[model samples]
Target: MSSVTTPRYADVAVGDALPSLDLPPVTRAMLAVYCGASGDHNPVHVDLDFARASGLDDVIAHGMLVMAWTGRVLTGWVPQSAIVSFDTRFLAVTRIGDAITARGEVIEKFVDGERRCVRVAVSAVDQHGETKTSGSAIVALA
Candidate 1:
């Protein structure tokens, strides 16, 4: 019998780390643009009165926007055919003027039967060291 070899997500060794991302800065104007682009007009993201009424002191960045930057880092490491899954958690609100960076570390790499795969621990943080989001990805290499 012959085996067809495919690229795997976790092919990287345990110590391998993906190239990180220094995302563009977040600004209030950017938030307005995002709100327009995404169509998530809950007011909490752009309206201060609504945000304060909802218990926050000020408008905050959309969690999904903050989380999605991890994609930039992950896609840089894995081929389009290799990714299997992706997700994240919101840890803290990112504010206008917050400088965010994305990073990932390979936690495990193993063969899923004949398919190679990788698992990464990922996070986004501000310059102040406040973690804005964290997540993981399980990729199946092509």
Candidate 2:
């Protein structure tokens, strides 16, 4: 199989934008599968009645699930081995049926030890343009 080629450090610049990833709408089945696969079966994410009882309008998507999509955006732009660190914060709940889009932009470039690295600002937004997750990632360059 052919391996993917990512941009070199010398070719990348601060303020460059990473490719965005648009995911399908959040669905109950997706939540259920993620819950099982990730071992994060929180009632708030998969049980509608439990969510309503907890004062939520309906069951919400798992925060990590959304974060994973953001990670996908990063990996899609750069090789997974180039990633040094990644982190995210949940800004808002993701409801079922909401479409999520993951985006990222290079914010800075620096050297850490012998590695050429870039810091990227990343986020995931809902169909309504509300940010549901925000984060940053550090990636080493070839």
Q: Assess every candidate by TM-score.
A: 0.85, 0.95
Clashes within 3 Å, all models in order:
10, 0
lDDT of 2 by residue, 3-69 (tens): 5566799999999999899999999999999999999978999998999899989999999999999
Q: Which ten contiguous residues of candidate 2 have the minimum total lDDT?
A: 1-10
* Model 1 misplaced stretches (Cα beyond 4 Å): 1-11
Total colliding residue pairs, candidate 2: 0
C-alpha RMSD for every candidate: 5.3, 1.2
The per-residue C-alpha lDDT of model 1 at residue 26 equals: 89
The runs of at least 3 residues in candidate 2 whose Cα sits more than 4 Å from the true structure, single-residue gaps closed, are: none
